[model samples]
Target: MMLPTRLQGSLNNELNDGETILWLDQPIASRMARGAWPIVLFGIFWSTFCAGWMFFTINMAMKTPADQAGLFAWLFPAFGLPFCIIGLGMLTSPIWVRRLALRTVYVLTDQRAMIISRSFGKTHVRNYTPEKLNDINRSLNDDGSGDLIFEKVISSHTHTHRNTHSLGHGGHRAGGGRSSRTRTSTTTYGFKCIKQAKQVHELIDGMVLASKPVAEQD
Candidate 1:
């Protein structure tokens, strides 16, 4: 499927001359499936927890003596009402996270790269000619999902520092502390958690090499 024209227009104006192409870090379907599993598991656990709390509250309220009844019974409904509402609200985060997870995006224009990451709105962009790319590779996880990897797409000419961080602290923190350090390294674009990563890597490798001038090859 193609991005709507309005979204296409939002691409940087500098990307005008050459064709624009998009790729996902993983297939959209695979991502959706992966994302849904967590939500389902969460619902199951949440329901169990709520049921336990409800049962406990009701039981405790029954055990109170009639003379003390006014206190515990009134307290039960007040506390339960809020707890129930909050438990329902917990559903929101997973749904939103799952929706975002279903997408892994890459935009390749004549001279730069843009990557939209998983389960969140983190977008990473890089500006560099193909000649600057040092290498490209495909990476896969044990679960058989993967993403294309672009190594060293930063060079002196295409480099700019306008956009600093993509997929900030929370997005990458789950995989560990890899993204925490502050540094002055050049930014590169890669497919993150997409299916068929190797295939995308090869396609990019070919495109980068083909874009090179004969003099550069020599």
Candidate 2:
């Protein structure tokens, strides 16, 4: 879908039509943003149940024929601990997944595409405008992991650099030194465990690079 006109430059200057707002997959958003706590709670409960069951089973086994078997008894507890730990960890995977989902935020605007990460407030806001956009590149690994890395189109001016740094890092050193680091004008966007991520990356990268004038094309 075409993005909103507000995001495009110059009211008179025609720009490629893309959707104004492309929200991340709603299923992803629902689980991460709205249903995270409940899911986490469910996971905790389930994990606890399995852990308890495993512990009980181990004790019972030790008390049963295994213990009477003598030499094999010590091996039971030794083997049980690792299995318990692994099961417990498996149960907690949802929490980690939830946190990852929570950290993800995606927005596309007229002037830029913004990603506001999950923190108390906007922790990471990446803006990709035409000027700062150096190059839009997409790469996919054999396993289907893909990324769209927006290269900084142009170096940040003194005032823009200073202002961005101030807001981004509380005025501390950011992006290495302002002089040495050419600030990225884009965000790192990827889909975890999602199929066809490379196609999506390529589409966005094409739109980004297409914005340049013919003479500017490399």
Worst 10 residues of 2 by lDDT: 3-12
lDDT of candidate model 2 versus the reference: 0.49
Tell me the tens digit of each residue's lDDT in model 1 across 1-218. Answer: 55433333444343566566544232455454555565556766776687788888778778888888787585774566665566565555555545544443466554545654433333434444576545655667776657556654444443333334456566752322232323354653465566566666666666676678878655
Error of 1 at 167 (Å): 48
Per-residue lDDT tens digits for candidate 2, residues 1-218, read 23223322221132247635433321153333343455546657766766676677667666787537575555555555665566555556566656655455444334455544444432444556755544545556576644445553444533333323333456555443333334435434433333345665554555566777888779
Any runs in candidate 1 off by more than 4 Å, and if so which?
4-26, 35-39, 62-98, 101-104, 117-137, 140-145, 149-196, 207-218
lDDT of each: 0.55, 0.49
Query: Which candidate wins on TM-score?
Result: 1
